[model samples]
Target: MRKGRGRRAVLAVLFTAGAVLLLGPGAGAGAGGPGSVRQDGERPSFRLRTHEPHTITPDEGDSIPPLTPAFGNTGPVAAPLGVALRVTVTDARFDTIALDTIPRNCYLAKYHRTLICEFSDAVPAGAAYELAEPLPKVSGDYYAVNGSYTYSVWPLGDPPAHTEDYTAQYERGKDTAVGLKPVAMSTLKGDGESTGDGEDTGDGEGTGDGEAKGGGEAKGGGELRFVSDGYADRADWGIEGIKLRGRIGEYAEASIPEPTGAAQRVRVEVPEGTSFAPLTRQEREGLPSEIDYCTRDAEDGNIYCSNPRWYVTLRVRIDRRVEGAEGRISVAEPGNGDTNPGNNTAPIKLEVEDGPTSIDRWVPPVSGFPVEHDVPLETAGSDDLASPPEPSVISVDGRTGVILLVAGASAVTLALEAFRRIRRARNRGGRRVTP
Candidate 1:
């Protein structure tokens, strides 16, 4: 009888110890349980709010503000150490706006058209996490509605940094969805036929036939002008594993609208320390199959494309990280009725951050990307520096200070602009930014 009692006591003691370790000290002491404490690994409870543009005009292919989502911890017990924000495109008929098309921190989901962007950061209680940059570029016909954007933010095991396993955090987080609304044509002016206010030109001169033609089938015989397609004001470079490298290596192309006459080659000149890398078969699969042949010039280190079909891509490579590397891409021969020769040649200037170190790596080119469908970044002006602006903390709801994380060059620019605008509103008078 005594042995039986001793065995029962031993078992009871072991169970008590196990429970204490799992629940932590003072378990279920106050109104809330020990799970509410950080030491006991409090689970983050949060809320999410989504913000999208009120309306968009298909004719205006220019980037609108991004699909901004905000999040904050709603639970009083525990402050989340870190979290991740994921924005997914729910509906988009055209593949251009798909997530894979987005540049950084984004990839294609299991469902082909679905795009998913995951950004990780430290999110404290009472503070909201948000993203603003690389404004999303969308295009659709008048009265045509694309799909909506769905967003969710959750705590991560290792956040402020990305981790492979974060599924459980999602279950404990929050989510919401917003629709992509295009402006009604009735509000626009003039007939759609005229290239006026009412026209939803997929490009500058499109007829809303679901095509963005520069000088091709849309408007025939205006002028056979050949210009560099998709030229940006500035190209910024980023650091790679402590090395100074092209964050998004420069890419340039000249889109041939239609056959005006016999074909001529396009010339792309590289700086002394840089060279042009041609697209491989896999990379060229999705691109237009119009390139007859491309070869690099031995003497001048220039690239020439002969009989390029719809368009030709020239991916720039930095053979040596030299300072002030500048190059140009242009049509070899001017065509008839080429009125705008100024835009014919686009210059490529590689801008690096303020300080560049000796860490440089040689990355081999497996494939090249087309400009039309690739992710693009832009800023208010070309004169701005490539590096992210200094950090600034803004108080939201007069509670906690929300610190903006610099994700990329474009994000840095847009976030700075957002702050400037907020300050401007306050300075104009006593303007209160509604939380």
Candidate 2:
């Protein structure tokens, strides 16, 4: 009877142990718990966080702080328009670094450790700077171990608009440094109207209806001519000689002498209703000094000289038929030579009697220098697109096996306790089990 009781007690304990195992923590899915399901469906993600070493938040009304003078081993440095910095760490031993500084509004963290440092405004436009060595690093007790870094900065704003009428030439050295070369005598001509347009009536020689009949010559008999000394001294560079002629209601023509050999004569017909203004030698230097002029009636406009080396002479041939129409030509100097070349060279004022039957004028080109450097060439092939690697699970703790062991031990302990209780109950009821 004792042996049967002991066997019954043992069987009761064994049955209780099995029931506990099937009903406890992980029993809902057999070998799979909620944690397992979550783990199987999740993926890994990463983020970056950065912080400045100093605590300096400017007040709303405070001006930006003056930049610290470049410190550390100094090489070459450019002034920065602004700076963005990122700091990151990867080891648990250095996690304290994250708490040492405030993360900028634009940063994040990954795995509670890794820190990414991005520094913009490292260099500035027009100003040069130097760096003696890589940014200083904190080690051992502070943050980051064996840190490595790289950086790049660009000119602060879009390349200044290239509107200076002068073509830019770039010269780049082996180190990718660039320099500018300027050409001053290049000219760009735009489209003009045809000779049939009723616009170019000569000064005061028009029939009052914007028309000049054939043989309707100027009452004041004079020829218009341009004169210039063929020298391009820095002070008086823009100079050229030419003549313009056309009938009213028709396109005018510009006849300029070529730069080479006694200035070869070339004629180009411009559209009618076109006005003309000849730039002075000073105003034609390049951008930052380019001059623009316009006129209501091209035939009577006066071309003023910006430099001492150039001048336009409009000779009027007064005829009996239009003698009552007084057409006087005047030249206005940009007074005192102290006026800002930019403002002093505003368009000249001209008044015509009936408008010229035709209008035309000769002007020098604003650009005439070879580019100093070749423009950057395009890449030969399509850029390679790199697909991001698929994310994989990464255990936060280095010893993942230890965590698994701990979980298994806890489950076993729970089963063992249940079995012991059952055996005690069985024994009290005259039933016992043996292992």
User: TM-score winner among the candidates?
Assistant: 1
lDDT of model 2, residue 328 = 17
Model 2 residue runs over 4 Å out of place are: 1-81, 84-240, 258-273, 276-435
Cα lDDT tens digits for candidate 1, 23-140:
5554655432112222334445444342322343445342232444444454443333354344444323224432434545444334333333444444454554444543244332
Error of 1 at 74 (Å): 2.3
TM-score, prediction 2: 0.15
* Model 2: lDDT of residue 214: 18
Query: TM-scores for all candidates?
Result: 0.25, 0.15
Clashing pairs in 1: 290-309
Clashes of each: 1, 77
